[model samples]
Target chain A: MRMDLDKQLNGSVQKAFLLLEAFTLDKPEWGVSELARSLGANKSTIYRLLATLEKLGVLQQNRRSEKYRLGLKLFELGHRVSIHQAVVHCTHPVLEEVARAIAETVHLAILEGTHIRYLDKVESPQGLKISTEIGSLRPAHCTGLGKMLLACADSEQQQAVLDATPLFAQTANTIVSAAALRRELAEIRERSFALDREEYEIGLICVAVPIFNQQGDLVAGLSASGPANRFREEALPHYVSILKRGAEKIREGIGNFQL
Target chain B: MRMDLDKQLNGSVQKAFLLLEAFTLDKPEWGVSELARSLGANKSTIYRLLATLEKLGVLQQNRRSEKYRLGLKLFELGHRVSIHQAVVHCTHPVLEEVARAIAETVHLAILEGTHIRYLDKVESPQGLKISTEIGSLRPAHCTGLGKMLLACADSEQQQAVLDATPLFAQTANTIVSAAALRRELAEIRERSFALDREEYEIGLICVAVPIFNQQGDLVAGLSASGPANRFREEALPHYVSILKRGAEKIREGIGNFQL
Candidate 1:
């Protein structure tokens, strides 16, 4: 991928992105020398990149520590992205209602490359909560929302993603083989939904349904999640039904949304 | 500033930012040729930059039109930035309460360079609203929140910003003169609050108080905004008191916040 992109992408532009990618929540701020060491780049080049990012207001340097961190411009642009997605805006109230009705966390996710990108979530009103951040991504092989998207994806898309993805087991119940994943996806497609019984995380269970556009194309997944003990086998039917209804609502309203 | 930054900032890096800035809500997507023409750059340079951005997932190219738009990577980073800003997390509930109590929009903003960057907002339950994006920046000379921040800025910091700022009037009531702005700041410092009586926009009035950290250092501005007719001089005392109390709450809780 790097070689392919290098043929088209300017070296400097690529370096700028490399710099931006270095800042994460766990390691949000970085001194120039430390960052250069981590990225295996020259101090001068890293310094130049940091200065340019600062000038663009994409990165801000702490006055006291002189360590660089992500800036407010990205936050502003991100806010625009959330509203512009339209699907998020259209389905939020529906998600809230669904979460309340199910007494479980409700999540809206879109298929991004080979992963599920959580676009929005409504926390369970109950004491036991399953929470995840917006913009967080999870592998498409182990989660209910991931399976829901993969089930609806074209064969080529599925093959391309599965070929690159390592099916690392997240839990004892995780389907770690491509053949098994394919079989599960086929079942999901037939049922128009997917379920994960402690696959992505221990003591957690999730059920998801595909959200479609007016043209009947899969756009996203709507999921209900709760603790494994509370979300018993008997509750599956109800959870699936409610998730499908919520997904249907999103599909009906998201036809006009560009995202 | 550009000249100073140019000594360390790479030209390619600056051009990359220009590309990102081109995508606004009104014109979110752009063809390569159109963007090149708009940015006054050659086709190859613009194409390379677009390719780099697309590869980084910071921008996505539409498959049909081949127009490039901001992508989910930026949205992801932006989400992280919002949560990382401790000030936002600490003050959100207070802003919500303030909005409800005043029956007007409430805003929390931080001084960023010579501008005020809105960190959070709670909309009025009433039909009328003064809505703004979380990361949006506005000149510090006109807005009530901006003036509140500027009133407490150190002398050197104030002079540096005022020297560079043009103070272009947004409305007939805007104080465009440097001397007049200085006088207003002095009055705001004495009163421990600031007011914008349709200075930024016609028919809109805002009252703002400075939020201080436990150490008594000014950190942010909390403001209540409503239509000019509704937020008249007669209501000033009530608005100021509410805002001050809200600001005090934030100050007490925000000492531990790193932002």
Candidate 2:
């Protein structure tokens, strides 16, 4: 029989993907019924798909919570793609130079789903350390990288992402409303940089500039961050200049394909 | 008819995932027929899966090559996992301390599939620079973390992996024979550390010690590397001591958090 490809795909495989897609940063762990409800699929169908995915190491069931979260296999696959390498390769030397010049923690990040995932970071030499994890996902709208990315994205895509994700009040300084976020993004675009003024966490402020690829596309961001007290508004211009220079250096390095 | 749970998977999703999985680091790009043969699925089924995955940004087709490879979305997802953060959170201070003491590049890496994926690196202020990217992946059997992980893995798993993968000689010093690799792993196990003597790359010698979780399971490895000429065997004991101490510090920071 001649295979009708479209007809064959309506079978088991597609259902499994939908089940996997039902998971999000906020809802990293999900029960079987919760997944079924989110995917709009039947409970039994979700069960089978989850079981298969679990076996493949695409998902892991928390024995205590009976909830499924994304598994390490995704990370294993990501390592092969070298995405983190791309970012770190592009920004590490620049970050080190920036950190040495400014003596503060420098960060490189990119938008991933609804959060900003830190790709690289250089810590300062002082006793006060700014801690940020490389693979950690933090709410993008409230982060310097997130705002920079949102500022660069088209209006429709920006709106779609913001609409889909909830804006939690991480700190009193966070922008909660769509109107406020839109305004902030506009301001960020004009300045060619963004600042996290204790938006995501108290006492931590980050200043970031966008990184463009050879195509002049906004690919990632580079930032200099430290305690809010240390990076006060008076010190803003210095941080912004260092960060912009670092971003430019990274862009040049990216264009040149330097390791 | 009663629903057969296995049969209820949306076939399109399964086919799409299988198609995506078909592309590997060795063959990052593949044509339709190659994908079909690898998946043991039909051409038409493969085509639809590729199309859907491409549309969702999970796969990309190189217009010139007409071959498919894993897309930026995987990187996006990996960025969400923040594995780098886990490394940074656990090792940043330790690396800083080590860099201050040793004056060399210190790196942290974990086994990702068949390669060692670098997650964090700290550069020394006054030495010959050997910059390693955070997301770079290198063959596990020849590098410091790779040999450490191999030593940690069960004999059966190690043999199975070695048998399945072709051992490519990256440098003249690299161990290409299974027997030699087995012997190296035995020594690493006894010493509680691994050494890379210009094995994976020329002019580089690395000494690494495994970091464990609270449960005493090997979680990752910490390594201090420098130019082979400068980092002679005379300094091996010092490097090993520093690496072990750094690994212990990281293990303490991580405690028991598996995530």
Which candidate number maximizes DockQ? Answer: 1
- The alpha-carbon lDDT assigned to residue A107 of candidate 2 equals 81
- Per-residue alpha-carbon lDDT of candidate 1 for residues A1-259, written as tens digits (9 for 90 to 100): 1323366568888777777777876788899999988987788888888888888888888999998889887887876663434777678768988998899999989887788999888888788977577787998888999999989988977896679645888999999878888899999999988999899999998899988888887778899988988867887888888887888888788874545
Q: List DockQ for all candidates.
A: 0.58, 0.30
lDDT of each: 0.82, 0.74
TM-score per candidate, chains pooled? 0.87, 0.67
Give the per-residue Cα lDDT of candidate 2 at A43.
80
Positional deviation of residue B91's Cα in model 2 after best superposition, in angstroms? 2.6
| Number of the top-ranking candidate, with lDDT as the measure | 1
Candidate 1 wrongly placed segments (more than 4 Å): A1-5, A82-85, A90-105, A122-131, A162-166, A190-192, A213-215, A229-255, B1-5, B82-85, B100-103, B125-131, B164-166, B230-255
Residues B1-259, candidate 2, lDDT per residue (tens digit)? 1112245544344445555566666678888887777766677767767776665556777888898777656665554454544556557778879988888888878776678877767886764887565556688988988999879876775876588545778899988888888888899999988999899889988888888888888788888888888876777888888878887777888887553
* lDDT (Cα, tens digit) per residue for candidate 1, span B91-203: 87788789888999999888877789988888888998775766788888889999999899888767866786467889999988888988999999999999998899999
